[model samples]
Target: MTATIDRAHAAARRGPVARAYRFELVKLVSQWRIRLLALACWIAPALFVAAVSRQSTLPVDTLFGRWMHATGWAGSLVMLGFAGTWALPLLMSLVAGDVFAAEDRLGTWRHLLVAVRSPRRIFAAKTLASLTVILLLVAGLAVSSAAGGILAVGNQPLVGLDGHLLAAPDAAGRVLLAWVCVLAPTLALAGIGLLGSVALVRSPMGLLLPVLLALALQLAQMLPLPVAVRLALPGYTFIAWTGLFTSPAQPGPLLIGIAVSVVWAATATALAYLLFLRRDFTNPAHDGPGRRAVTLGVLPLAALVAATVAVVAAAGATGPGIEQDKVQRSVATAFSHLYRLQTAQLNRPDVTEAQLAATAACNKGGGRLDARGPGNDWRCVVTWHLPGIEAAGTAVYQLDITPDGRFMADGDGPKEVNGYFLVRTPTGDAPNPLWQFDGNVALLPAAPKG
Candidate 1:
């Protein structure tokens, strides 16, 4: 009978509860913590950009994909990764943590609770307000990062991982898409911070703890952690999937990374809700047996995951060469579409013995007929026949590889011919998909062709 009366009274206080929740926004913004958080979020990216500009380790030329990423949209994505990893999450935590703790710190939480009459409703309102702020901060960071990256670097052609360069227009579109991908990872961390804030009521360090945790998880990801465990870490979607900018794009890893970020965020949020519901308001919030157990539960899980990864790595390293076999299998499977070599050279009724031998050798060598220096296995080849003078001419072109792969036969034969070749990797005998080459390459005023 008494419990029913108390429940009815609590239900009747809905108007004051709603007002207290709205006031949380005004209270959170006025704090110096909010100012510091905003600065941290903005400055972290700016510092990274400065570091990139001043750093000497990154070369300006084609040292693999380094120069290309530093040059355009790729550069901006790099800055966003570092910023998004901890900066955005930490900023949200700063406000969210204070939302609960600030009331306790002011010693006004008790008074507000009596006015609101419902603890659960107040908690919900506080959480929603903080989450809204987190979303805005992240959006601001994204816009600023894009603007800075385009201005500092320029929207130039992105040299893809496959070593092909992309023009500025294409690069711009990718930058926008990549920035949006970061939101999932950020949201997960923000959820974690909110949970910590709710559980630990008044500690300023509660906000800082999630930031430290985010950093730790990132470091773990770089180590020999299992793929399953690595996926749980925030911001991994940025790297595992972002590498498609490399040549021969692979989306498998990226898809998996996004899946992992989504799952991690969802699970963390569920655990948070459980903690909030079970907590005792009248007990005055000590890190007591209840909170201690929740914290300790994470320990065995971390160790078990860590040990499993270490054992798997050690076992794989000790065993017979499975990794090598996997690579060989993947390469062979990737090239399975390549076909047998056939040639119809010039007006000659039959190809000369030399031409036939060259084609045979090239086929056996996986399409690279480079009889000189180191060899390559790309199988797109082009051969041409024309009457030629004493200049170098195309004896063979492998159209099966990207970034154009082939060898030219220097013509001492005076066949008076010019042959051009266009290659795309491992595609079977089509007459020509399309060929992009100009024999003259460049031209000037009235140079007579004899």
Candidate 2:
């Protein structure tokens, strides 16, 4: 009886933030939608892996799709790309966007703010609760996708974007790291959802706004925007994990992407908090955003646009573009490593990358003299010395380069020379290491003019 009384006193002494947080968590736990979303997060990826595993034709369009049947690691990566573009933002919005809007819909905002008598505490509690759910969902998706991939296809060595093969253990580590990297951008989207939740009182509007914005941002990213402009947006970071799989992992863009994402999340969440404070909770008839909502929203959005414009203007002077030399160097190095792997698979005498001495001359826009910048028109001719052969072997490649510093190299060489889409190896017919590859080009300042 004494111990029970002491526990009661302890619960009574809990601070308002803690109490509110507990309340929000309990409410979320009681919701069927939240429960269903959590279940989907865990089960959907597994089902996706199973479905992909049964396909006779691989999704060659996706970065890791060609290897989906060869290794479970590739299956996880293929899912990662798909989730980034579609599932993740929608999932985040469904929860964070509804957290506040639900209270409005249920007419509980007056009680939460007036009866509780602390809007700030309530806001803090709701934000914390929503973020907890979001983080858990993301982590669940990552773990489920990885586990499902391993179960469906087996954890074989993964092929890196830079054409080097990663051991199963190393690939596992990189896959985890890649998932971790995506969390920043995902949180940024959550912040956008939170803003929508507070600013748009209607549940449907709050839930759909962030998803719509994400779609728009993705479309904008695909355009030939300035490098700075593209990098400033959080959407670009969704695919930034590609750099982690490169031969010399390009941490430059990863760090920048994380920093950019943090800034976006901070600013957007702050604006959401400010708007939440200004909301007139006593008015039950407030169906749409009021004058203050429009004012507060416009100010932050305008500032963001101004900052982006300033960055774009500053970057314009440098004439930033994907360098031909960098592309040539990166693709050539990656090709040598892949070639060595292909030879090893065929039981040929082991050859070293140094021995091959590969070199590539790449041109953009169909042999234009000034062959620089990101585009799908880039072409490269690679020449390499083969062991015991007098003439250097040659391969032609076409590159589709994205503005955010990734490129897909498709071998245009004769199938007999470059090998077909699938190559016969001791293990079976695995993906040809030469038919297609991926690589990164670091966005560095161009060389100073002589």
Candidate 3:
């Protein structure tokens, strides 16, 4: 009897949020769907690594796919790029979008509300639990993919986006950091899903709405919008990880991306909270907030939308687009690194990047010299000095650049010197470092116009 009383006191001391969070967590874990989702997260990455590693053709289009067979770090980065596009948003939506709505479907809203008198506490508990589950799933995927890649292909140094090489240890640390960075935008995305769950009430609508919204935003990002508008988007955060692999490891743009995502998340969650507090659960017949209440809630949502747009537009007016000078420097630097690697592989005289003296002349479509902004038609003529060659050689590289400052350069090279698609190295035939490569420029706002 004394022990039971003590236990009761101990439970009370743990606080309501803790108790509710534990209860929510237990409920989520017990669900078969959640378990299956966890299982898939664990198993899918391993399978993907094994399957891709065995293929003869490399997935060259993906950021790190060219080196997937060369290093486990590359495989992990490849998966990160792919997952950022679709898998992550869908996975987050599945959990956060259903947490609140499930109570409506099960006719348990009143029971839950009665059990937790404070609606605010209930919201905190469920949100925390859902976020916890998301973190677990992400961690599981990262581990499984990394382990599988290492098992399939031995851990080796990785080639950075700027053509610099990262040793295995440094690469591992960066890979881990990259995944950690993913959580910011992912949480922001989860907030949107949570908002849907609270507002939609119906399980199916709650689950699918966030995913559709995310898809729409992703498509919007592809449009040739103003740089500021694109930068303000939550979807841009997904590609923010690219900055971590650059030569100087610029976190400035990545931090800005995170800030934009945080603003979106905080606003969405606030709106969801406002709606949740105003809702009336007494009427079992009603599935969601009252019509009048919804109208009132929408006023704030609309205001938020307008404010966000205004701020983004103002920023866009001052933000820098992909500039010609930055592109030339970025391409030229990467070309020098690739040239060094190509020469080293051929057992030729060792040449340093400084000795190479690489430079690039870039132009956009319509033969616009010194062209600025993102497009597919950008072309660069890159020239470099090489030992044992009489005159300098030039390579024409076709560049497809994105709004986020990442570009893929495809070289129409002098194959006799640089090797075409494949290079004969002492180790074996490998993808020519100079044939094609990726690069990133800093995305920052320009000086405000006078």
Give the distance in Å from residue 125's predicted Cα in candidate 1 to where it truly belongs: 2.0
Worst 10 residues of 3 by lDDT: 292-301
Runs off by more than 4 Å, candidate 2? 1-14, 308-320, 426-428, 445-450
Per-model RMSD to reference: 14.2, 4.1, 3.9
The TM-score between candidate 1 and the true structure equals: 0.58
> What TM-score does model 2 achieve against the real structure?
0.90
User: Can you list the residue pairs that collide in candidate 3?
Assistant: none
Give lDDT tens digits, candidate 2, residues 1-450.
999999998777567789889889889978998899899888889888868877998788788888888788888888889889988889878888888889878887767776567888888999999888888888878888888889988989988888888999999999999998898888888888888888888848678867887898889877767667666677767877888898778775576678778877887899899988877677897775667666776577657856854764575523444788889988898899889888987888988898999999999877765777778999999999977899988999999888766788888986854647778878888668788887777664543679
**Model 3, 1-450: lDDT tens per residue?**
999999999888568889999999999989998899899889999889878977898898888888887788888888888778888888878899899988888889888988988899889999999989999999988888888888889788888989888899999999999888888878877888888888878847668866786787778767767666666667676787888888877675577667777877787787778888877878787667646435644565456555655676665433446788889989999888878778878888888988889999999995854488788899889988876677988888889998767899987767754438888878998778888888986666443568
What TM-score, computed on C-alpha atoms, does each candidate reach?
Answer: 0.58, 0.90, 0.90
Clashes of each: 23, 0, 0
Could you tell which candidate, 1 or 3, scores higher by lDDT? 3
Query: Sorted by lDDT, highest first, which candidate order results?
Result: 2, 3, 1
Error of 3 at 373 (Å): 2.5
lDDT of 2 at 348: 89
